[model samples]
Target chain A: MTDEKDFLSGYDPGDFPAFAVTADVVLLTMRAGRLCVLLIERGGPPFKGMWAFPGGFVKLDENLDQAASRELQEETGISGIDLTQFASYGDPDRDPRMRVVTVSYLAVVPDLPSPQASTDAAKARFWPVDDVEGTLAFDHDRILGDALSHLRTVVEYSPLAASFCEREFTVADLRRVYESIWGVDLDPSNFQRKVLGIDDFLVPTDRQSSSSAGGGRPARLYRLGKVSELRPPILPPD
Target chain B: MTDEKDFLSGYDPGDFPAFAVTADVVLLTMRAGRLCVLLIERGGPPFKGMWAFPGGFVKLDENLDQAASRELQEETGISGIDLTQFASYGDPDRDPRMRVVTVSYLAVVPDLPSPQASTDAAKARFWPVDDVEGTLAFDHDRILGDALSHLRTVVEYSPLAASFCEREFTVADLRRVYESIWGVDLDPSNFQRKVLGIDDFLVPTDRQSSSSAGGGRPARLYRLGKVSELRPPILPPD
Candidate 1:
């Protein structure tokens, strides 16, 4: 054992346990009115042929955020979307090979093009979140559950639900983002009233969305508001 | 580079990242009407003599939770308290010694005895949360801030604030937990009403706390109720 004099100078890093750190991104979006997540199939061993959240090991030179971005672009062909560092999973047996800890990231994207798989992925595509089964390659089933719960909780107080909508959208569009994610039918009038009651929750735009066919009235468009926080946050029903 | 045939056969885990994983526990407890966090002074580099959250490297045989428990006991000698995994920090430049990613855990312990520094620490003690300047080594200050914010938010809905108190405590005790953490004053009557209004928040105990001196009154003692969720969460004052 080294004394204070030999502590820093003769310290051997190998004396401590070695662990690999990876990043997993849970990219959620709405397609055909159903919530979906981006997933990839591994081209190589360990969990080859099984579906997993798009991810890879972090590089020595890169930060966790940069690694998440690079992996997102490599696996899903999506970039510039806001990614939040959600949580970390470090269960020793999570990885079959050895000790591996993964930092999980979450993002809600608008309508996106089909994803293309590269690097270690055999294929990449958007799969409906409701259709997800326990066959996920790792602890991803648990990770996805955590991400969904966070989404449910935060969407109430934040403009997070709007991230799944177009730049200029209607109250109906925003409501659908909540309805689809929570998998519950929100009373249209009450949700509209509650959202409007929240100060600066949304800003009314001059233009209105075109109403199709039967000639109902075109709904007014609203943009994301400047208010950062919801004081009395809108919460999901008990 | 190995071909598909040789990929599985020749895969070397060391070919990728070689990061050392660590568990940092942010143990918070109220001492003398103030919120305090347990910290340790390092005896060796890379940041010797500076204060840091009680933490150390994960051992090969121990899981992350076990590492956190061991590190906490080694640094502060406080055990049997529940520690929750909150987040992970993996910024490349976080640790100057080597590539290390740490999972941060949040623990709320009741009034504890003075801590004894063991293992790698020179000294261990609880420092008031408000007194913590950015003088913390590594990104511990940021991690501490995140834990405090999470605490302030969750204590309203979750039974988190109670974790800082002994069993069968006064409403004043619970209110002090909020006041200390949020650093705000709660109107006594309104606070009591709101807390009691939350169904099953507390169950009255037959015992009453002894009145300190004069004739104010002995506060009622209550135990935690079975209700798991707080429907309408209590919000901090604006």
Candidate 2:
């Protein structure tokens, strides 16, 4: 007790190196049959003019999730999207300005309107996940890869793929969501059978597609399921 | 670009409130047919004497995962445990000393030797998950709840439940691990059917438990299979 009291009496936070925390967001949405990630063109030094996830320093008052939402809203003028804190990155040399540890958030939504850039971003847009040309600023390239991998896994077990569809969609539409994100051509009948086999995975509506795009039969429409997770997940092809 | 340049020119990490980062670990293991978590007694003021997860400030040179492992070893004298970064905690007033953000890791293993406390921890021991008496120091109570929920879910889809058992175990031993952690009574025959249905979930071994405590036929022992995930997750009873 005497040794502990003595140590506590002289304990100082200043003894440790200063750490700055930031929240970065990897916002994903389906656009034109492709998975796209929201990126910003940095307008200042420290990877200026390079692309990176929409993010900024976490404020003193707000929590990490709030900081991530605020950064997304401030930089891209897009808000009201549900965000999940997926992972945190804290490599000592990740940021040049200081020892910055970033908590990364992930959000996947249906297609969104074009982003309006502000703050330290020269421009904001959703780039196809596979089409990003060069390295992202900082360790964002790694963060993006992690977020994508996480997204791929979750969609298999959760109703997250429905998040990319409209309120009511046909089996083909849902299959396309899996195909675009997983980057695999799944047999239409097989995909439908797998998804339908999962109890409560889909709620069939008493309607069909207005236009018979195939000129044979209008696909049956369905809504999101009552349950959140998919038992017997629809596994992608090898 | 001009506005961004001006903002960057005056950007100083020092301007924001000083922040500290730490790593905490939730060490879980099966003991006496119960799930237990390793906790340490704080030796200093501000919740002194309260039991909390083994943790300390993260060093400048180490990454979050490395920091978590180091803290677990430094405080509890336990090493070689596999740790997964489950979540991060960064409420503004979580720590009275300063604005501290903590990355929390979770580890489950076969029973370990009794812990020996050091560093700022006055004592260390494994407490049954159901028997944690008082509120844990800081936001650890919430962190513990989250870690438990995550453990329960992962065990259903992944081969993590086997982590609590010996290298080779019987179907009954494996069932006990899930039943203990999930707090449920599972029918033995039904449980065996569910597990065996999963492809590559359990590999049959040529040995059986020598002592058939039940004066009956000895149960066959098996090891973990090659597949990491279970395609059709064994959902807990509603």
Candidate 3:
């Protein structure tokens, strides 16, 4: 074994079959009070013409996070968003042609205009998360499920829920993000007390949105606070 | 861009460099009231002669979980244990020799004898997790930290805490598992009530431990119950 290890130290790339590693971005944003995911229409085979997460093969010089961000920029003309590497999918059959291991990332951004398709995709669009009724290309269906579970679990303990909102948002706006993702309606009074009571979860801002939705008293706006940790985390439904 | 996608589809494996993917096991067990991790002394180069997590290169046909479990069984001669895939580490430089991505898993088992070394490892032994004081080989230090955090968090909301015990265990025994992992002292009265009050968390075994450690009354033995989900999970210390 010692000799084998020593011999392998100088192992060359030609020794084993090369595998392509890529990063797929599940860029999520809130649109019309519903959670939306950014997806692309493939322009080439194997799964050409099918909807998939925006991504591409990783460059040899970049790390996983960098690759994910780069893919987002290259494929969607989107940039400067904070992307988190969530998990890696490596089922042998996940890819058809050869072995491809995809490191999936979750990117949260403020609501924005439709993305301009670039690179290998024919079209880029944000699909309401609730509307993912059709089968996704590749093993993306499972990847999306894992991302949603991670988001649901982390939202309770981390201040990540605010990432989907604009710089200034009302308490109702923030509540909708949680309700939309968890697929449950929360008691408005309890939800309000919980968010505001958490001393550092939100920072009050002296801003207000124009009375747009309907005739009601203008609501105060708040921005995401600097704190990253949430105390006594708000657990999701069982 | 469409043409570029077409070019990529025709791209051969020979075009890109091949990289190896591996799985490492953070196999954990409770022994003599202390949390212990399975470690193997490397018999190969790179970090030859140092202790590290039990792992190996993944087989082409096996899934990530299968590879991890196979590695555990090969290294420790243990099988049929429940192992959970937690995270994947893929820093290009994580392994100095090549670009290696390692999927890590965490497993809990009842107390077992010192593992016999097998396969690539020269020696297999269980070390008290607290005693792993220095840096480990191949980015294992970071992997260990992530696994421990997952364990601490999962124990609260899942029935996994009892995986460290035999089919029947006393309340004191279960409390010891919590203390070993959290490194905290808990009030026996409160802990007992909390565990018992959570319906389906545990069930009476119609049995009793041969003796009690604190001395006074005989301790009742119980087995894990059917409930898979935990409500109002036991939160760790602030």
Assess each prediction's global lDDT (C-alpha) against the native: 0.80, 0.80, 0.78
Tens digits of per-residue lDDT for model 1 on A63-181? 88998888787665678989888889878788777788899999998877544433344466778987885677778899999999989988876788889988898998888888888
Candidate 2, residues B1-238: lDDT per residue as tens digits? 3322222224865665567888888989999899999887676777887778877777788889898887777666678878889899999988777788989999888887544534444467889988884578888899999999899888877888888888899999999998997889999999999998889989998888886555877889999898787867777876
- Candidate 2: where are CA atoms >4 Å away? A1-10, A115-122, A193-208, A212-217, B1-10, B115-122, B193-206, B212-216
Model 3: residues with Cα > 4 Å off, grouped in runs? A1-14, A114-122, B1-10, B114-122
* Cα error, candidate 3, residue A147 (Å): 1.4
Q: Which 10-residue window in model 3 chain A sums to the lowest lDDT?
A: A1-10
Q: Give the candidates in order of DockQ, highest first.
A: 1, 2, 3
| Candidate 1 off by > 4 Å | A1-10, A113-122, A212-215, B1-11, B113-122, B213-215
Model 1: how far residue A198 lies from native, Å: 1.7
| Model 3 Cα lDDT, one tens digit per residue, B1-238 | 4322332345765565366777788988898888888886666678887678877767678777887877777667788988788877777787777787777889998887444544444466888877884656777878888888889988888889999998899898899899988999888899998899888998997778887556777789999998786776776676
Tell me how candidate 3 scores on lDDT: 0.78
RMSD, each candidate, Å? 3.5, 3.5, 3.0
Q: Write the per-residue lDDT of candidate 2 for residues A85-150, one digit (tens) a residue.
A: 989999888877778888999988778654443444457788998888357888888998989888
CAPRI grade of model 1 = acceptable
Clashes of each: 0, 0, 1
What are the clashing pairs of model 1? none
Per-model TM values vs. the true structure: 0.91, 0.88, 0.91
Model 3: pairs clashing at backbone N, Cα or C within 3 Å:
A18-B18
